[model samples]
Each structure stands twice: as structure tokens, then as C-alpha cells.
Target: MRLIQINKTYGDKTVLKDVTLDFPIGKVTVLVGPSGSGKSTILRSLNFLVTPESGQYDFNDHQIDFSQSISNKEKLAVRRETGMVFQDYNLFPHKTVLGNIIEGPTQVLKMGKKQAIKVAKELLAKVGLADYGDVYPSELSGGQAQRVAIARALAMKPRYVLLDEPTSALDPELELSVLKVLLQLAHEKQSMVLVTHNMAFAKQIADKIIFVENGEIIYDGDPKKFFSQDNSSKRIKNFIASMTMENLK
Candidate 1:
């Protein structure tokens, strides 16, 4: 997926200005930045969840003008290929684990109940929650909830997944569960863009790291190069210093 000269503004204040970058498919690309740095906006814009004020988005073979009016069908079609995993699990309170995972496919995709349930079961097993299908979201730990969210998104068979601080709301141990599941997806050749503050995990699982400051990409290159840059901006260096393996250990 590619963003070309993208720009977004709220009234007179611009959030992202002329941002252009290419996210390689079939690899993990981590987007790192402090709060309100437009990292989340960039991710949201890809799905037209937050339409940009200007610029073009290039998907596998289609071009989308952020400024153009889009039909609901058009938008949902794009969204199907671009799944989002939020900081909160966003599971339905009344739905069981299996219900939550299969809801979208059965309801939105018009899939049969049995087919959706079959797929949901396979995904639950994939995320290491094979025995939790009958449980409700309220009964699961944060990590389990988040893993279910991942499975819910994956059930749609998205070509690219967008994650916004996936572990932010979890305790350290719970965070590991979510991270381990995502890390395994990297091995599966899942293409994803993750917005995270977990620098240690970024270095470990990301094939590329995009550093953003004040809404612009300051660095977009190999994850190792990001760590070794002597001339790295103070903002980036400071960000790195804040990350510790204490949580990972």
C-alpha cells in the first residue's frame, strides 16, 4: 500500500502535510511517534475511516482520492482489505468469543452461519484461544480479548492490518500474549502497519520502522539503522531510550 502526498487538516490546523511513503506488503512496518503525531490518522486514512483533505492512496491495483466522495459499498470494499486492531478489544458485550469472531462474516459478508463458525474456530486456534470459543469477552483476560480481536479482524482475510497501540491497555504479562500472536503473524507473511510505543518489539518484529515527528516521517528505513543512527534526531533518540526490555523479560 502507498500514501502519496497526503494531507489532512482540522479547520486551519494541519495534522499531516504532504506525507508520502510506501509500506511494503507481506512485512511488518512499525509506525513510531509520540501522541498526536498523526500516526493513527495515517492508519485511519488508509481505510477512509478519517478521510484526508488531500492526496491519493494506492492499494494493490486501485487508486483512491481522499478528497473524493465515496459510496458505502466502495468504502466497505476497501475496509475489507484493511483491518484495524484498536487499543481496546472493542468486542461486543453480548457476544460469545465465537459469535464476535463470526459476526462480521455472517452479517456483513453474507456468509453462512456454519461456514463463518468454521472459519472462526480455525482463527481462534490460530491465535491460541482454541478452548475459549464458548466464553464471553467479559470472562477473558486483556490479552485473550485482544487476541480475539485479532482473530475477528483476520476472519475477514484482510490484505493489510492496521494496529493502533495494540497493547496499550494491557498489563505487561497480558501484553506479551498479544505481542506473541502478532509476532507469529510476521512469520505467516502478514502485511501490517503497527502504531506502537513498544520500541523493543518494534525492533524485533518490524522489517521497517517509520519515525514520525510533528506529523511528518523523519525516518523510514531498516529497523537496525534506526537504532544505530548517530545523527538521529533527539526526538527519536529520546524515544528509543524510553523503551526497555524489562517488560519483555
Candidate 2:
């Protein structure tokens, strides 16, 4: 999957400036940067949650030209190809965990109730929530609820999962559980693009890391090389130093 020269602006602010990226299949790609650096914007653009003002996006045979008129056909295709997990778990309050997972499959995919439930059960198990399928989101801990959100996203069997701070809502101790689920998914060779500020999570799960700031990409490379002490970018160096200090505190 690739973003071909995307450019987006909001009023006087240019949030994304001529950015282009290629995401490897079956690999985890992490986008790390400071707040308001356009990291989340990049993820949203990738998922077509918000179309960029100009550029082209290509994934397999799927393509969208933001410079031209977008068709509902392309929107549906992209929705099928990409799944997004937001900072907040957007589960339905009235639905049980199982119901939340099955809603899209049964309604959107047109799968039968029995088959959808079966698949939802499997997904619940995959996210380590097999026993909680009957429970409500409000009954689960923050970490647990986030795991269910991941399960809901997976039920679509999307080609790429786009996560925007999947662990941000949890404390350090609770964060480990959510991070573990993500690592497990990464091991299963799920193609993912993540927007996060959790440097530790990025280092643990990323095959590739890109640093974005001021609406532009400053660095893109292997995790080791990008995080190496000898890496010469002062901006990224300062970011690492600040995050390290914050972690210690």
C-alpha cells in the first residue's frame, strides 16, 4: 500500500505537505511524532476518513485520486480494504461485545447471523477476550475494551489496520496488555499503519518507523537505524531524549 504524494491543508495551516509513503505488506509500520505533527492526519488520510486535497492512493488494485472527484464505489472499496481503530474505542454502548463485533459483518458484509457470530467468537478469542463476548463494554477495563475494539476491526478482515494511539487511553500497567495484543497481531503478519507517540511501543512492534513534524516527513527507515544513537537528526534526537525523560518520571 502506498500514499502517492498527498497534500492537505486546513485554512491557513497545511497539515500534510506533499507526503508520500509506501507500506510493506504483512509488516508493521509505525508513525511517530509530536502532537499536531500531522501523524494522525496521515493515518486518517490513508484510511480515507478524510480525503486529502491533492494526491493519489494506491493499494493492490485499489486507487483513489483526491485531485479528482471521488466516487462512492471507491469509498466502499477503501472501507473494505482498511480498518481504523481510533484513540477512543467506538463500540456501541447498547451492544454486547459479541454483538459489536458481528454488527458490521452481518449488516455490511451480508453474512448470516450464525456465521457472523462464529467469526466474532474466533476474533474475540484472537484478542484474548473469548470469555468476555457476552459482556458489555462498560463492564470491561480500559485495556479490555480496547482489545474488543481491535477484535471489531479484525472482523472485517481488512487488508490493513490503521491504529491511532491504540494504547494512549491506558495507564502504563494496563498498556502492556493492549501492546501484547498488537504484538501478537504483528507476529501473525498483519499489515498495519500506526500513529502513536508511545516510543516504546513503536520500538517494540515496528519494522519501519517514520518521523513526521511540521506537516512533513523528516525520517523514514528501519527501526534500528532510525533509533540508533548515532542518528544525526537533532529534532528526533531531542524527541527521544524528552520521551526517555518522561518515561523515567
lDDT of 2 by residue, 35-88 (tens): 999989989987778889999999789777899988888888888878889878
Global local distance difference test of model 1: 0.90
Please give, for residues 59-86, the per-residue lDDT of candidate 1 as tens digits.
9777888788767877888898988899
Report every candidate's CA lDDT. 0.90, 0.90
Name the candidate that leads on TM-score.
Answer: 2
- As for candidate 2, its clashing pairs are none
Runs in model 2 deviating more than 4 A are 246-249
Give the runs in model 1 whose Cα sits over 4 Å from its true position.
Answer: 229-232, 244-249
For candidate 1, report its TM-score.
Answer: 0.94
